[model samples]
Target: MGDRATLFPVKHVIALDVGGTGMKAALVRADGTLLHEDRRATGRERGPEAVVAGILDFADELRVLGERRFGEPALAAGVGVPGVIDEARGVAVFAANLGWRDVPLRALLSARLAGVPVALGHDVRTGGLAEGRIGAGQGTDRFLYLALGTGIAGAIGVGGRIDPGAHGSAGEIGHVVVRPGGPPCGCGQSGCLERLASASAVGQSWATACGDPSADAAACARAVEAGDPRARAVWAEAVAALADGLVTGITLLDPRMLIIGGGLAEAGDTLFTPLRAAVSERITFQHLPDIVPAALGDTAGCLGAGLLAWDLLSTEVSA
Candidate 1:
């Protein structure tokens, strides 16, 4: 290790959002502006080494772009992964989607990127942080951020900060069993909320209701608009299941708001109208929190990773 730590204060940090299908990286300024961005597919089944290599390569590209565009390569980096993580120690404790266990992600990243201080976090939590502080959950102290895409996941935030829980699995609303031995989940559990309320679940349910497994969720929404009985039943089930779990969260945490973010959230009123109605129908005693779509869209996680990098980089620059 070089002994010039004090001399080379990194002015910025690169941020990466690692997902099952792809990873995104960006060089961001202190004001949350991305100066450079890049992405690569995450061939996770190729093994951990290959996935880490791809991330490092993404970092290298960011370094070059940052130096050319922002006058210096980022002094540090922050990565957000979609799974259980020990952010305090920079280790990826588990990634069910990637099949990783006890990976020293921070150490690997630091070594690969040449000793830059790297911060690691749970992707959903970071995305939730972004939404809570700058997007739909902004100005709210306690809120739930839900992502309804290929899989269901959520971020729990209170007072503008996401709480990863003592085990880094605090806001996994999708795993709450709703159907109880109904449909099998990838987690090997039956009738989890994700299998009932996720985007894929929505598509699958509608298809089954129509006796056609090829039904597209979007197309089904269109059919529902035209009063298709099968589409209405499928959509209604998804909404009801979501509301079941949402009510639990609301009763337990009493959050001030709920921010729905992800592919299904993009469905606009098609999803929200029914979901809001379902949740409202179930609530009885407490003041129901506002439900709104995430303002940052799919860019939330990347922006949040950048925000983390920026926080650490600012400390470095000041020191």
Candidate 2:
């Protein structure tokens, strides 16, 4: 009994990462270790109200689990949501994936959790926060974290903080024009970085070139490795566009590191080797930042939410 009691965490926080399709959540100890973790569908097809209700219910379940296991409720909670977020105001300004607009997420979660301090954050920014503090970018003062999944997005970190910018949309690097007059983006921009280099973009390009609708980026990478000329061309084009956008980012941000993650990054050296060479060739006088893969994988956002909750707890104690 004594041993079991001693194993229980003295304090904890709730962390939730809400995405378009699903949510990842955790109960984390003060020292940044997860005590419990869970995943649930977002059910966005049911509408935005249902998604909000789902988040609240999931959070409540986590809190109850924490109390039962640790003998107390969590000290604080943090949520990371996609799209334009007003972290300062705790509002989800707009999220097309979940169809949220001007949702007072933090306040609602706080109330649901019985006044527990709640912190709201942008999803990519929160994930970058985790990568910078405890993952690949740990100990680095400046870095850019890029996720290249179905779409592309970025998080800029400076001095151990994720810059939210004036409007909380500072790191929308995907929208940067890379190949003007090229393919159109959902954002209404033609030849945006994401449209040219994201995983979905690569898949579309490969499918078109190979005349196989089911072909994807990973298959393209495998074909490249196998010395297929068409696959190589497709891969090279995506890499070139990505390098162009990255060069622009490097010139502007001058980060010490560039951490790449997401489904596309799974190509490992097939992506990094060519990407490094391309970025290097484009650099004129800029100091080259170390390009690396993200260490936390899919859990970065949830862990980052934990960090936010911990930060909130610290801020309250100081106050």
Candidate 3:
């Protein structure tokens, strides 16, 4: 036995996305291979402190699980979360949904996880990176990966890198005010793209139109399938708002492809059908990028964070 440590691969990374309801974690190889995966409830209702503890526990569990299955400790951890992040500073400035403020999550995780290099990124931007590098945007230099779910956000990819901008708040397309005075958003803004085009908006708008407070987007879609005129109208508004946002993006970035992901993208043709039409209607002379659904679904963020960790490792090894 020359050197037992030399037998193992040079790098491994844990990708974790801490959400309000739960956390998604996966052990990934340098080449973006999935070595293992684990999920656990966020326990956020118990408060922010408890949520952090739960994440630490879950991460520890994964470290043990990955080591048992693959025979090595994780090299690094990439934690993705929603909020106003100062990526360069490795801090979560504010996360409204999580009630996180001025939280040095990277430092916290780093201290807890034994000085393993920890990278923290915005959840949506990280997903965008994954899409741009390995999934639908594998070959594209310029692309926009948009996530339309409970909220709306995007990843702006240029020259094969996701640019999170100076404030790490670059791709907040959802907060772009479309209507001067429309529905209120969780961000405390009115007429945001989120209020107009998000999955919640589609369902809520439909329910309100139909004079039923209980109906959600899924039920509204069902109503649409049953030919409910009001449901159709609500869905149309969402499609139109999304298209408007897309048009703005195209005008600014001129990306060659637009990747749509998240829960609403699951609608398949129901989304693409009218979305394409609306986008086409807005563009007069410019060429429209191919709008396609994201290939990796929700796992894009996990895979992307792993990719970032791999990148960090490679950079260090070569240096």
TM-score of each: 0.91, 0.96, 0.93
List, residue by residue over 1-319, the lDDT tens digit for candidate 2.
2213336456999999999999999988776798888999999999999999999999999988887778788999999999999899999999988998999999999999999999999988899999999999999999999999888899999988899999899989999999999998889989999998999999999999999999999999999999999999999999999999999999999999999998899999999999999999999999999999999999999999999999988888899
Model 2 ranges with Cα > 4 A deviation:
1-9
Per-residue error (Å), model 2, residue 56: 0.7
Give the C-alpha miss distance for residue 77 in model 3, angstroms: 1.1
For this target, which candidate reaches the highest TM-score against the unseen true structure? 2
lDDT of candidate 3 over 133-251, digit per residue (tens) = 98999989999889988889998999778999877898889998888788877788899998888888887787778878887777777776788788888888888889998998898
How many residue pairs clash (N, CA or C atoms closer than 3 angstroms) in each of the candidate models, in the order given? 1, 0, 0
* Model 1 RMSD, rounded to 1 decimal: 4.6
Candidate 3 is scored at a TM of 0.93
Evaluated against the true structure, the overall lDDT of model 3 is 0.83
Looking at candidate 3, the ten consecutive residues that score lowest on lDDT are 1-10
Candidate 2 has an lDDT of 0.93
Q: Which stretches of candidate 3 lie over 4 Å from their true place?
A: 1-11
